[model samples]
Target: MASAIPLTRADMKRLADYAKREGVKAEVQIDDFIFRVSADHPPAKVDGSEESELDRELMEFDRKHGYR
Candidate 1:
């Protein structure tokens, strides 16, 4: 298991400043100093045809039951 690291006020301020300067949003994880910065935009939509294993199985079941 990973240990969590506490961030000081200065550290948080610096990170916030950097994120603001870069014009992105920061997602910080305390357990692993992982920062995920993304632009302030809508997330991309997934294609409808890209089905997961569970989705495929459910579709097969539906077809067998003539529920389509």
Candidate 2:
């Protein structure tokens, strides 16, 4: 399991400053290259196609069973 690290006030300030100066996002997220305080890329997108397909299949099954 990966451990979590708390960001200090200075770190938050730097990130906020960078975001404001660069016109990036206001969202503060720790990515793979965490603690950059000035990372140029946005956070990676999470893929949920498999989960969505499973949900659709489950919905279809429920409809077939008159449970929907």
Best by lDDT: 1
Per-model clash counts, in order, read: 0, 0
For model 2 the TM-score comes to: 0.33
Candidate 1 least-lDDT 10 residues = 32-41
The TM-score of candidate 1 is 0.37
Expressed as tens digits, the lDDT of each residue in 1-68 for candidate 1 is: 75555776677778777777787788788665765555455577977677576699999999999999
Query: TM-scores across all candidates?
Result: 0.37, 0.33
Residue 5, model 1: lDDT of: 59
Give the whole-model CA lDDT for all candidates, comma-separated.
0.74, 0.73
Q: What are the runs in model 2 whose C-alpha is more than 4 Å off?
A: 1-5, 26-68
What tens digits encode model 2's per-residue C-alpha lDDT throughout 1-68?
77666677787788778886886765555665355444467677866998899999999999999998
lDDT for position 4 in model 2: 61
